[model samples]
Structures are given as C-alpha cells and as structure tokens.
Target: MDRERLIRYLSLLVIGVAAVLPFVLEANLYLLNVLILMLIFIIFSSSWNLLAYSGQGSLGHAAFFGIGGYASTLIAVQSGLSPYVTIFLGGAIAAGIGVLIGLTCVRLKEWFLAMVTFGFAIIVQAITVSFLASLTGGWDGIASPRLVSSQVPGYILIEYYSILAITAGVILLIYLIFKSKIGMAFLAIRENEIEARVSGVDPVRYKLLAFAISAGLAGVAGALEIHYFGYITPEIYGIDISFWPIIYTILGGLGTIAGPVVGTVVLTILWDGLKVFGLTYERYIIIGAILILSVIFLPKGLVSLPDKIAGWWKRRQKKSPDAGT
Candidate 1:
C-alpha cells in the first residue's frame, strides 16, 4: 500500500485505541485525568500549530485559552445554561479578541509581533484580576460547570468519549481546511507575502481568519479543561499554558496536521515518566535539550525521523556498492 494509506490506517488505529482506552483501564481516576489533560493539550497545540502554519506565531495563546474558559464559565453560571452550550459562545468571544489582536499585529515584524502577542496575555490577566474583578473573582477565579456531572453513573467514561470525539472533530476540521483554498493562501502567504499579494491572495484577510480560527479553537480547549476541573483561575493564562503548545507543536512537526497530536502525546509521556524519577526543573531542561537536538538533527521534527533514517541507509548502501567496485 501507499504511504498515505498507511498513515490513514495508523491514525484510525490510534484513535480507536484512545476511544476504548477509558473502558479498557476501567476509568482509573488518575489515568482518566491524565488522558483528559492530554486531549486538552492536543487541541491546544493543534490550534497553535494552525496559527503558526499561517505564518503567525502567538506567544500568548493562553490569553484566548483563558478567555474561553472564563467566558464559558460566566455564561453557564449567569444564564443557567449547560456548559456544553456556552462553550461555543466562549470560543466566539475569543475569536473576536483574536481578530482585534491580529489587526494590530498583522503589519509588525516577527519579533515585534511576538512581543505584542506575548504582552496581550499579561494584559488580559491584569484586567481579569483588577478591572473585571467583580465578575472574574479577581485572582480567586470562578467555578465552571462540569460537562458531565459526577452524579452520572459512568460520567468519567462519558466525559472521556465526549472529549475524544471533540479532538477528532477538530482535527478533521483542520485537515479539511488544509485541503481547501484558504489553506493554499496561508501557505503562499507564509512563503512570501509580497508574492502572495501579487497573486491575488490578501494576506490581511487570511491572517485575520487564521487568528480567529486558531484562537477560537484554543478557547474551546481551555473551556474543556476548565469545565473538567470545575474551576478557573488567572493562572490559566500563565506562561506555562502558552509554552506547552509551542513545545508540543514544534517537537511534533511545525505546520503539519499530525505534528501537534504526535508531539503532545510523546511529550506528555516523557514528562510523566520522568516525574517518577522526581525531577522538576530538570524535566524542562531535558525538554529544552531535546528541542535543541531536534532543531539541529530533525529539523522537520520527530515525524520525519523515519524518512531521515531511510535516506541515511540508502546513502550508505550506495557508498558500499561503489567501494566494492
């Protein structure tokens, strides 16, 4: 079979395994929690990857993430609506803010743009704590209604399946986008804005679109996380939230559909496994080292490792044949 077919089958297998994992493990509390967190990160990282794919990198995506959580929580509480219903509204709020940010940053150079986006998260945090203190609970945060209540007989399984389905749906949406005209425009813009503009692709329009979609999806992830936790805090916009997506996306494969998924899974495993050895800061240090090595050796990320090895073996075989002659 062709390589694409192989990838398709493999992806299906992974999804199937994840779908059944909760039942297989009998919903162990710790394991279910870990898996939930991983799924949330998968969404978060993929959202960040989408922005990056559009040639715009955000350092403060946690702003949108937190906004989604806060918005959903507030809406659910104030309106007495189900959390699931409010999640979309939360994402919409984030998308609006994202468009505003995109408008301001679209003209800036990479470094300036990064700094502005990074500072926006801090700004949002400050507003949540001080300006919006009345509603935001000012550092104390607020409670978010759960997607599936604990009163349900097998709530954990239900929640797990719901999140898994969301994960797949989001990924499928991204895949479809990548196959469409908008995706082509993003690639062109990323490669050369001047040329893309000449080619009738409006960089401004597409970039804003990217910003909105990416931020909205990130918000969805944050909403899910907060709902699962049944609480929210200013800490949701912390630097760690911002950085985790970057770590996962870069390690998986920048701009590729599967990069965030693979990267999040691998790093989550590594992070947890290493904790068994009682490492804290050392864990980050190791991650940094891996990233550096990856940049140098596997510039395309871990997804490309197999191809790199194959190329090396081919070169070795060719050299051996020539040497024998």
Candidate 2:
C-alpha cells in the first residue's frame, strides 16, 4: 500500500483502540485519569508542534496554558457559565495575548525567540501571583468546577469520554489545518522566510496567526486540565508544564501531526511505569537519558523508527548478497 494509505489505516486503528480503551481497562478510575491527562497533553503537545511548524520555538508555552486555565476558571466562577463554555472563551483570551506576543517574536528566530517566550511565562506567573492574586488567589490557588460533577453516576467515565472526544476533535482540526493552504504557507515560512515573502506569503501575518491558533489550542488543553482536577494555581504556569510539550513533540517527531500523540503516549507510559518501581527523582534522570539517546540515534523521533529499521534491514540484505558473492 502507499504511504498515505498506510498512514490513514494506522490512524483509524489508533482511534479505534482509543475508543475501546475504557472497556478494555474496565473503567478503572486511576487509569482513566491517566488517560485523560495523557489526552490533554496530546492537545498541548500538538499545539507546541504547530508553533514549531511555523519555525517558532517557544520556551514559555505555560504562559498560554496558565492563562487559559485561569481565564476559564475565573469566568466560570463569576459568570456562572459552564466550564465547557468558559474553556473556549479562555482560549480566545489566550489567542489575543498570543498575537501580541507574536508581534515581538516574528522578527526573532531560534533561541532568541525561545528566551523571549520563556521570559513571558515568568512574567505571567509573577503577575498571576502578585498582581492578579485577588482573583487568582495567589499561590494558594482557587477551586474550579469539574467538567462533570462527581455527584453524577460514573462521572469519571463521563469525564474520560468527554476529554477523549475533545482530544479527537482538536487533532482533527489540526489535521485539517495542516492540510490546508495556510499549512503550505507555514511550511514555506519555516523553510525560508525570505523565499516565502518573495513568493507572496507574508511571514509576519502567518506567524501571528500561527501563534494565535497554537496558543488558543493550548489554552483549551489547560482549561480541560484544571477543570478535570477541580483546581487552579499559579503552579499551572510552572517551568515543567512548559517543557513537557516540547519534550513530547521532540520525542515523537517535530512538525508532524501524529508525532505529538505518539510521543506523549510513549513517554507517559514510560513515566508512569517507572513510578511503579518507586523511582521519583531518578525517573527524570532516566527519561533524560532516553531522550538523549533517541536524539542521537533517531533524530526524526520515534515516528521515524520504523522507516529507519526498514532501511537498515534492506542495507544488510544487500551487504549479505555481496558477502556471499
């Protein structure tokens, strides 16, 4: 079969498995909770990948992530709107802020842009705790409404399925975006900004649009997470939160739709699996080692592993024939 056809089938198989996972696991709340969080990170990681696709790397995505969670929580608390409604509103807010951030970043590239974004996260966290502490509740944090109240029967199951649906929808939306003309423009800008501009694709406008969309999606992931946990804190903007998506995207495959999903799932499993062995701080060291190894051996990320193996096997087969001759 052709590559595209194989990919399509594989994607459908993955969706099928995800759909049946609840029953396969017998609706275990702990596992469901992990799955839910994994799905959220998939969204988050995909958002980061989208920005990277535009050739902008951010080190402070937690800024948008926390902004979304806080905005959604605050709006839900004051307006008495459903968490569902407030999530989108919060994402919109993040998108607006992202556009502003993008304005300062469009001319910058690589680590310079990364440092600026990293600075924003710190600035945002400080503001959340010090200036917006009245509403944000400072480091103490504030309660958030659950996506589905625990009072409901099988609420955990409901929450899992809800999050799963949202995750699928987000991935689908991203897939569409990646296949569109806008996606082509993003690719052009990433490869060569001068060439893109000469070809009539405005780098500045597209970069800003990329920032807005990526941040908005990240906001949704953050909103989902806080609502799921039923709390929000300045800790939502922590450095680890910002780094997780970058790690997941890089490990899976940068600038690919399935890369985030594949990377998040693999790492989440490895992370939790290690926890079972009572390794806490040590797990980070192990994970770091694995990431380094993957970079050195499979720089295209796990998604490229199969192709790499296949090519290696073909080369070995060819060498063996020559050896016999």
Best TM-score among the predictions, by candidate number: 2
Model 1 lDDT per residue over 1-325, tens place:
6988998898899999998888798889988998999999999999999999989989999999999999999999999998888888898999999999999989976788889999999999999999899998998888789999989998878888888999999999999899899999999999999999999999999999999999999999999999999999999999989999998998999999999999999999998888999999999899889989988988898898888899999889888857546
> Residue-pair clashes per candidate, as listed?
0, 0
Top lDDT hit: 2
Per-residue lDDT of model 2, residues 1-325, tens digit only: 5998988898889888988999999998788888999999999999999999999999999999999999999999999999989999999999999999999999999989999999999999999999899999999999999988889999888888888888989999999999999999999999999999999999999999999999999999999999999999999999999999999999999999999999999999999999999999999999999999999999999999999999999889888857546
lDDT of each: 0.92, 0.94
| Regions more than 4 Å wrong, model 2 | 322-325
